[model samples]
Target: METNLNNQISEEWTVSEDAIGQRIDQYLSHKFPEQSRATIQQWIKQGYVKIDGNDTKSKFLLKGFEKIHVELVLQDRTEHLPQEMPLDICYEDEHLLILNKPVGLVVHPGSGNPDNTLLNGLLAYSSEQKKLVRAGIVHRLDKDTSGLMVVAKDGETQQRLIDLLKEHDIKREYVAIVRGQLSHTGHVDQPIGRHPTQRVRMAVHHKGKPAITHYQPLRVFKHFSLMKLNLETGRTHQIRVHMHHLGHPLVGDPLYGNPNRIAADVVSELKDLVRAFPRQALHARQLEFIHPITQQPISIKIGLPEDMEQLLEDIEYYDDLDTFDDQMDVEYVE
Candidate 1:
């Protein structure tokens, strides 16, 4: 290993007989366990790695006893500025923070949204969190999906939390209003892929990754149902895609649901209420995970936001009316 006085670290590795026919990226990935193989491949592609003093590609096949040199510089990710904003913190400790993110709050800065995000707010909240990448965000909730998310206070905690998520050790439950009545507990086990033609949507395809959603009907209404959902895997838009595949897309889901047709299913008085819904009626209602630092368990539960609560009330009212009409019809027949 060699070290420069500046912020870069340069190291050398000798390929053993066992590593003879491996690709350069694979060899380096084995050498450095902490860094992701994708990161290492990016570094190699950018000419940060050399085999026998010559710049080589990631797929360069190695022979035994070849000397490989690597130069690494910690990534600088402070391009985004911090902004002062209010946060709905659920729990906080030295290692992590659990918070309820409200609707319309983007989790991170993206192409259209360059600032004023949860990441920006977290940066302004604490200096330690500011230094970490993406404000130490471990997982993400869609901008319209309001609910619990955990943020790490440091890098180690962030990695551990990520590992825990990959292991499926973290538990997440959601509450959503979906179209049609579902009376029984259900599970959706399907593969999800990007839409073939519709780029913004996800669909079920054989080539896609495995995704599962478990849901139980909390309340069956006239045209819509309140559901309690548990996720076995957290793929992008997993619940939305699975529900849509089941022919019962989430209420108010503009991308995958029949938002426009929702008004037609309800009565004349409730059409306006259905049409006025802003976003998907999905909320991360509960989150349970083991603490990375404290080695303790944590569980959090949040109630439905006011808009969803109002929507449920409307569903119940219409459902009651539907039941009454059925009863009246039965009496008339008798």
Candidate 2:
């Protein structure tokens, strides 16, 4: 648990002879009162704290004075606290805004991702511009899905975008890198709903929502394939489920893809890069729509994030997935 200063991790400390027979979490509490005892215990249970370079539960008892280490991951505590995170903004106006959301940036606040979302950053940006948005977020992108996304600044704009989306006036096109070499063109017209047995994942449920994805092979890599995707109807996990149903899983999709499939050499030295490759490799490259107020056509394009860029650069590293169908296997572990 040695922390590297250059990496902004505080140097870890060890328990001294003066502290012995103290509970692991209790000792941590005594040292870091700024961090709550319960929070420390929770982090320990989440494997944030390591005992002798091994994972330990929060209640793991301490025998005696030991060279124990503590590594604390930062989490936001204040309500509506704004962080100045760098944003790749592509377009902005009085009623709407657009940006190239980098991979790993969650769109909205959720269970664990309350702070540091694109929403939080937008809120901060709007505050200075004398604007606010309590609602009006037209659509969402999964935390790991990078690319272009639009946010409505006001209620009227939001409603207009929603209507446009319903009427298929807003065209959202995505470029994805999947694990297999696909055909020149294909469409996955599958009904997607909550996976019957695996409630956490969406699948091609018999009584699912109508979902269709039109895909065209853009570039064929050795072991990977870049495909252009168009959504006929947007549902939860539409592209992911449709592609998976059609036997193509996005490269880094943690929930759907092979857990052990990523190349180790690409991110061998970067632990965060390896772990950060947890989300699906999907990016909304293009967003086109007619302006609600001006009625003018608006289009925006975003480039790949650093990780995706690097991943694409290393495509030739692996041999082409020639027997992709024969070797491809789908296990329903949802």
- Per-residue CA lDDT of model 2 for 35-129, tens digit only, reads 45666788788876777788887667677645565656454332465566787778988878888878678777878988888777766675532
State candidate 2's TM-score. Answer: 0.65
Top candidate by lDDT:
1
Cα lDDT, all candidates: 0.83, 0.70
Residue-level lDDT of model 1, residues 80-194, one tens digit each, is 7778998999999888999999999999999899999999998889866754667789889999999999998866688789989999899999998898867678699999999
When summed lDDT is taken over every stretch of 10 residues in candidate 1, the lowest stretch is 325-334
Q: How accurate is candidate 2 locally (lDDT)?
A: 0.70
Clashes of each: 0, 1
User: Alpha carbon lDDT of residue 102, candidate 2?
Assistant: 81
